[model samples]
Target: MILLQINQVARLFGAEVLFENMQLEIQSQSRIGLVGRNGAGKSTLLKIIAGIESPDKGTLTKTKNLSIGYLAQNSGLNSDTTVWNEMLDAFTAVRQMESRLRELETLISTQEIDSPEGQRVLKEYDQLQHTFVEQNGYSYENEIRSILHGFQFDATFYQQKVQDLSGGQRTRLALAKMLLQKPELLILDEPTNHLDIQTLAWLENYLQNYQGALLIVSHDRYFLDKVVTEIYEIARHKMMHYKGNYSRYLTLKEEQLALDWKAFEKQQGQINKLEDFVARNLARASTTKRAQSRRKQLEKMERMERPQGAEKSANILFKIDKPSGNVVLQLEDGEIGYDKHVLAKNITLDIRRKDAIALVGPNGIGKSTLLKSILKEIPLLKGTLHYGTNVSLGYYDQGQQKLQPQKTILKELWDEHPTTPEVEIRSVLGSFLFSGEDVEKTIGLLSGGEKARVALAKLAMNHENFLILDEPTNHLDIDSKEVLENALIDFEGTILFVSHDRYFINRIATKVIELSPEKSTLYLGDYDYYMEKKQEEAELLALLEQDQVKEKSVSAGKQSFQQTKEQQKIIRQLQRKIGQLEENLEQIEEEVSQLELQMTQPDNLNNHFALIELQTTIDEKTIQQETLYEEWEKASLELEQLDS
Candidate 1:
């Protein structure tokens, strides 16, 4: 059940080899995570597998009728249609089936009943219906709704044109459509780029149950651990496999590197001993034969190459020249936004010295806006912000807006602090992995990760006691992110930053502030602790809701019992009244019968007055009987209604 197999795969860019002789197999339902540093050709390898790019030398085999869906980093949907319509396009086959079924239905209606033509049309319609159902045509819209909701695209966005959406929104839509496509093999490159923590969690759960094979390229370690079962590490121009999640892979890789280094050291020692013996004994006549033997052995031995270590990561260090006051920053009832529109209100924060606070919220909820407001780059709609005495601030824009596009990497750092010597500047740049010609490269030409490094190098040079950063780990690789986290953890300055990297936050943050459109809530610990507290709050809310429901049920039960009792009492009264009416009716009937018999007698017939009196009495009895019968009917009807 192998979906794809790549053998002897090699890719080259000019004279530089990105990777060579790489081997990999993607079996049915495999969950693989492909990880490497930036510019390591992880995306290129995905393109090769997806047939978007061909390898310089390799053989790629796939099972017949294999299907693949590839989503590149920042890839977006360019459709002009509305979001709902674009999603419906994923079910083109089902839509076609529906069309054919409709046509067949019309044809059947026009033909004679029970005729051969009509029967043929009906049969075709039945077949089409079966196919539609098998393809999930009936619930396809529901499926789309579920995916849209998971991606945070609500009903308000359904009718919005795709062309009007942002790049991140478009990327989300692309992913949503691909999920609906349900290809046999799915490949995603940095799919978590635009997703928040909630959506990321939802996607992790969704992919865990996905029936198709998945090959994901992402720097999100937490995401890889949750979704992928295997790791394919592209390092040192070769592919290596590990049979576990990202965390497990790190442990295994460290162990393997240690073993490799030991073996290499042992081989080097043996070679050195042999060479020394040959050098000392070659000229001596008695040991000449032994020396020749040793020389031959040395030449025939297989030499072990030194094991390559992990790729070089940026060396980030944050230091402050002076200490800040105990209260670094205080905001009272702060409101942040642009123009008159407020993104968040009722925000109050007290940041102390040496505190590392992580700001987290859904996308577009204004975490970045809050940072800008604190920096005074944007006017606050309301409230006041106070900075402590002697607090020098350093800001790192995740967008890298502070770095001039026209300046070179070296100049970007040099211009910030011209007093520093050229050699010292170069040394600082080298620490950030910018060396030789790399320092000459312009900021505009650099990749996201490279730009981030240059920005960090500048931040390092600034001796500020307080740092405010926004999405600082956006494009950083896992190794670089770890280095940055370590530096921030060691920094003596107070920090307030916004980030969606849960792992980074968990490592470096001492406090977390969750922002919403309405207000902000503070948590007294790291990302894990914050999540635990939020989960507890949710459980408590659920219990409260359950209690409310139980209370309502109990109250309703009491009300129903009282109503039933009242109805029973009314029913009993009606039954007694009906019995009394029936007895009165019997008495009236007997009196009437006696009156008729007396009237028939000869004596009574002779006297007109007596006859009249008898007739009047009979009439009175008849009227009474009619009244009793009406009353009994009414009582019986009421009793029956109560019983019912």
Candidate 2:
């Protein structure tokens, strides 16, 4: 079923038309990704669709009683309520039903069994109870717990006021609440903002199985590829829809652009031929009739507009003036944090020449603090750090604090290199996408993206052999990010940067170092490789824990022969348990299936009591099935460990 339709929609900001005549339809389960460069009006279009803002022209039609949840960029929950209470608000309707059910239960018990009032109360109680079960009233707390855990909020945070949480934590809580609300249509603007890599993975898994439709606007290509099945791109005041994920959309867009250009050129050739014939032959007596006919044909022919090409991207290039030593930097048993509070300890790292390393960890794990310590802006609470001979370092701050707000963009770079000619400085700034009048824009007046470009231009001018960057892709659009990735990939220098962008890390990092509160772990390859290794490590740890438990169960070490027999017996028991759990799950699934079929029967649909009973039974069977599946998985894992 179509949940919403956007027809010939147009929006304007001041005198400028942001977009016009945009058409889109959202079905019940559509997973759409909206992508565009910064200032291309993606968010504006979302607002128009979400009914937060009306279109300047045209109309939006939504299904009757349609529900929509919209999360704007960096918009966090502002309630003074505790985290648990804030989440409880998502189920207000269910809670109200629960209250009604309790009242009916009281009324039913107090009245005579056969009386009219008693019968009415009983019926009301039954119907409300069924709805309560259907709405997951019994399991909603579990659902809340699951989502909160996925967002990295533990039980300890349950009583914490929402207003007291950090900005990023509040943003995560807002998203968690939205997911629990489960609106018919979810419109998110940069939902991935302020999320760590681990939280991002959890969100991707949750959204992939979301019951409602999704309309997401994000610059995280990796996320778009994971969660969305279709791409809607806005560019040049036009919206184009592509039927694929982000990566596939790129390929399909390129192919379509090629086809569009070919068709345009073919039409242009015909137009030229027709004009030439009309102009040359209109004056000739023999061909005058033919020329007039051609002219008439030309006037009636429909012309194709020129196909749009690639948008302008920042021209970023990183170069090294001199080579660094083979061993660029080293830290031994470092503890990083502020003042006397050490956030992480036992950190050690080795940076080699030409290595592109990615630093990653959970939020507040001190990834940035470690970088600052390396730059000497702060001292490491403990341990020795050394820089290799002939190493020249350049740093990119995530906050862009190094930029002087009073200076103009032109002077930002030019002042650093007074010996260079003004034209040359302007040229470098132009490469970073600052041109002509843009060069004179004050640093304070520029947007985050503009400041990033200016900082990068200055970094490139330094020509350092080693670069340390923090969240370098924070404010960049997709195009600008790709350009920066390409530049860093080709740079003849060593790099160690911190970013949550998995795609960027995959494209640029040769090594990945994951920080933990206790120690740092290194992976030999890019983001995907690191994930694979982490999964393997987790499995190994699980198996080791199982072994420890098994060892504790034994009274003493037995002879080799006896131990072998005992181990075989344990494996056989695990296999039997696994089989039993599987059978239980299958039986529960069959029961749920039967209940679902009963729900569709006309007899049950027409009878409120029968329908409610069937729904309640179905919910019970589903819970049982989930429990069985969990047991089955655990038993299967144990059996596999024993066999291995």
Candidate 3:
């Protein structure tokens, strides 16, 4: 059954047309992943379908009883409400039903069907009760609570109000509410923006089992693959449908592009042959009519439009300056964190020119703080920071610094560089997707996304060798992220950045430094390779534990004789385990090195979702490796104790 049908949709912002003559149909139980460059009218189209916004020209049709639930990119909750209360609000209908059911119950016991007043009350009561039960009014709240817990909403968090939670937490809560509403079609915009790997996986599972249709906009390739069964790619002012996941979409797209090329080539060949025949034979009496016929045919033949130029997206075409020196930036013997907590201590860092560094950490572990420390905004408490020769610093603050209240958008950008020409400046700003009237908007009036674009426009001004970026992708739509990633990938200078966007990190990071409560360790590779190394480490740990158990069993036999044998066995095991860890570590490191090099290639970033999964798997591996190493050390010490 068709859940919803959108036909010939057209949305215009100013003079630019978002898309025209676009058509898409949502089937029952279908999952569609909507993808396009930023500013492609995806959100606008979704709103038109949801009846939240009107399209300039379009029609959205849906079946009767087909309820729709939409999740906006922003947190859709009253600031003062508690997390638990917000979820319950999703069931406004159920709340009404419950109240009505209670009222019916009061009259049910006393009313008789035969009495006119009693009959009226009794009939109304029975009908309301049936409707309540049909809607499953009783269990919805309880079920939603379970789902909230699944999304990492602990019971304690339920009492915390919306105003107290982080933006990420609010996004998750909103997701939970939508899940509870149980709409016929669920439209989620940038649903994975603030989600962790675990919560993302949970959502994937929930959606996979969902009976209703779903359409979501996300840059998380892994989440899209795990949930969406179809993809709608909006580009060149048209909607193109693909039959499978992100991988399949890429594969099918490549094939289609190839076929399109071939078709154009074949048509050209025919046109050329016709032209040759006409040129030679047009003067001959017998061939005059034939030439005329060929000319007519040529006129009727439709030529393909040339594909957009190779570097069509960005006009400036980012080119980075050469590295200044060996040491770009370094932190020595540093304690980094705010008051009362230390993020990383007894820490030293050595950064070299042209080395792409990815700053990674869990929420609240202070990756952002560490970035701030490098900027010297946060006091290092007890550390010396150093910079290399002529190392001009270009900063991409996580908040995208245009976030600071200012007069106008143009002024926010202009404040950064006073000398840049207005024409050149606007051209650079346009490359980041800000155009015309957008440059005039006040900083206080700009959306988070608009502010981010303005910040990027400012960053584009500095031709610095060392770029310090903090979540450059936070507000960038997928298209802008890709453009930014491509630019970074092509950049010749050094980069040290923090981002929650795994897709972007995998494409550019030459190294990953995971900031943990225990310690910050460097994984010298791209996201995918890191995961592989971590997996090998986990398996090695598992094997080590098994071997240790076997060694203990052998060590348990006799007092004197067994003691000597046990000691000897212990020596061999220690030697063997140490050798194995060394070997395992080397193997992972080697693999990571190769993968890191491969990630620099353009083809590697093509499948962004694959990279995300690879990162999540790597993170799990790193944790397992840490646990194994701790166990191995403890066991080795005990073996020494037994030897004595």
Provide the global lDDT of candidate 2 against the true structure.
0.89
Clashing pairs in 2: none
Per-residue lDDT tens digits for candidate 1, residues 326-373, read: 999999999988888888998989999999999999999888888888
In terms of lDDT, the poorest run of 10 residues in model 1 is 548-557
Per-residue accuracy of model 3 over 1-644 as CA lDDT, tens digit each: 99889899888888989898889999998899998876677888888888898778878888998899998886655569888787888778878877875665456456663689766765565456456556755456547667986788765677798988777777777788888888889999988877654466577888899878998888777678778889998887888999999878878988888888888888889989999988998899988999989989989988886554223454334455555787898877777877857777766678998899887765677778888888888888667899889788888886655355756767766666678788877777788666898777777777666677777767767787888998888876665677788888888788999876666778999998777654567789987776677788889878986676434433445468866776777677776876677667566545544544443345643433343344345445555555555555665666566543
Please tell me which predicted candidate would have the highest lDDT against the true structure: 2
Which pairs of residues collide in model 3?
A: 221-609, 531-618
Off by over 4 Å in 3: 12-16, 56-58, 91-146, 150-152, 164-168, 196-198, 275-285, 299-304, 307-311, 315-333, 339-353, 382-392, 402-454, 457-461, 531-644
- Residue 371 of candidate 2: its Cα lDDT? 95
lDDT scores for all predictions? 0.88, 0.89, 0.75
lDDT at residue 74 of model 1 (Cα atoms): 93
TM-scores for every predicted model: 0.82, 0.86, 0.70
- In angstroms, how far off is 602's CA in candidate 1? 88
lDDT of 1 at 303: 91
**Candidate 3 positional error at 640, Å:** 31
Residue 191, candidate 2: Cα error in Å is 0.6
